[model samples]
Target: MAQMRFITALLWLLAAAPLAAQEDARPDLSIREPERGARARTYVLASLIYKDAEDGIDRFPLAVPELIQYVEDNTELDVRLRGEDRTLRQLDGITLLYMSGNNAQLRIGAEDRRRLGRFLQDGGLLYAEDVRPRGLGRFRFGDAGRSGTPFDRQFKELVKDPDILGAGGSRWRKVPRDHALYSSFFALPDGPPPGAHQPGTITDLEMLEYRGRVAVLFSDLNLTYFWGDPQAHSRAPSLRFGVNLLVFAIARQQAGPALR
Candidate 1:
């Protein structure tokens, strides 16, 4: 009886050991990417100077806060908002670099331009918007009160492939009804603001190849204007476009890896 009792206790101990080991093991959540098999790591870089009210520019409010909400509602991708205190070296970990025109000071410099070139070459996707003072397309940098259209001159140099952007310099074109972004991520009232709308046409779209990686760089079509405004619930069209742009960014990144 004693020997049989001891054997029973030993079996219990052995069974519990595996469970204990599993509990002790640290889960590598870092390697996990977004849902739907998205492997791209997304990062938002914001400049400190852009937020300073003393800079004369009306520090626009569209930024990481809005991005966080979008990510929470949309995808499971790991997203982080980085500031100037961080090193440019850490940029390697990021697959998508969101350049909200909020950081005009950083985007306009010569040395910074060189760094941006290398970043794009190393498979980093850029989603740039001209979020000038006042409203989304109302303020251009240096040129006071100028309409904040797409930063054409700079992108023209980066996106050398003419096919990326149509004959005109607009990076954002009307996303057609049959486009992957329209069906997969957006549709009708819920998707990209329908094909028959005013600004939903794909007038200026670009699929530029940089460092063997094709990137779809685009403007948010007045997205920043609608952000952070509680009274603007009627702007469903703008919000849908914002969501579509994100889906497009992630989808474009995945396209390269799939072909490989």
Candidate 2:
């Protein structure tokens, strides 16, 4: 009887171990409310679940808070940072969805893809960034190559989905240096900042335009890391770039039928 009880206890602990690990993997999904009567723009960071891999979301936990502080301090925009780390199912009223990860074959179900499609059609903007650190080397643009980073391959898969940005003949293309987004708030005369990765070549912001509105923007330079440690790295320019993106997203939403 004593031996049987000991074996049962051991089995129970083994069963609970995976559950504890899963709980630890999921970050807090709490939403921070804005000040009373403040017309705040909320940015939601998407926490994705990759198949057979540890959670790759929330790579730079400090990125969002730093961005919120920059926009509020430098601009008149009422920026509000909220959401602990949310999943796609919790993204109903979110205006801007920010996603970062490094899973090569990251997969989103068909239903989630449809939901994301509707979000863009309703004037929401999706911004995705490759969070892989520098010195990792470049991702192969075309064809399958082992040299490419996981994020590079995942980003390609994300924008190529027919139900997502690829619908209605939409596709990702480089944002022009003279585009209004470059000058939306702060003038990015030189365009995106040079990071450890993709140094000196970060000229244009990649965009996916649908019905004349930029529905999605992708960056491979790891801008989030710049925001992660602004003071330590003197990342004011990268913060400015983030501000421009938020301002541009709001403007597009206000443009309404003009965007069509």
State each candidate's clash count.
9, 0
Q: How much does candidate 1 score in TM-score?
A: 0.49
TM-score to native of every candidate shown:
0.49, 0.68
lDDT of 2 by residue, 201-243 (tens): 4445578766556677877767776776655465887888887
Candidate 1, lDDT over the whole model: 0.41
RMSD of each: 15.2, 18.4
Clashes of 2: 0
- Per-residue C-alpha lDDT of model 1 across residues 1-260, encoded as one tens digit per residue: 42232233333322222121244363433322224433334444332232222232323344435644754565443333332322333445444555444333333344444555555554456655444334344332233212343343444543443333233233434434454444334454333342211342333323444423344454434344454343544555555555555554444443333121
Q: Worst ten-residue run, lDDT, model 1?
A: 12-21
Off by over 4 Å in 1: 1-59, 71-90, 102-110, 132-150, 154-178, 188-207, 211-213, 251-260
Cα error, residue 119 of model 2, in Å, equals: 1.3
lDDT of 1 at 181: 44
Candidate 1 colliding pairs: 164-206, 164-207, 172-204, 173-202, 173-204, 174-201, 174-202, 174-203, 187-191
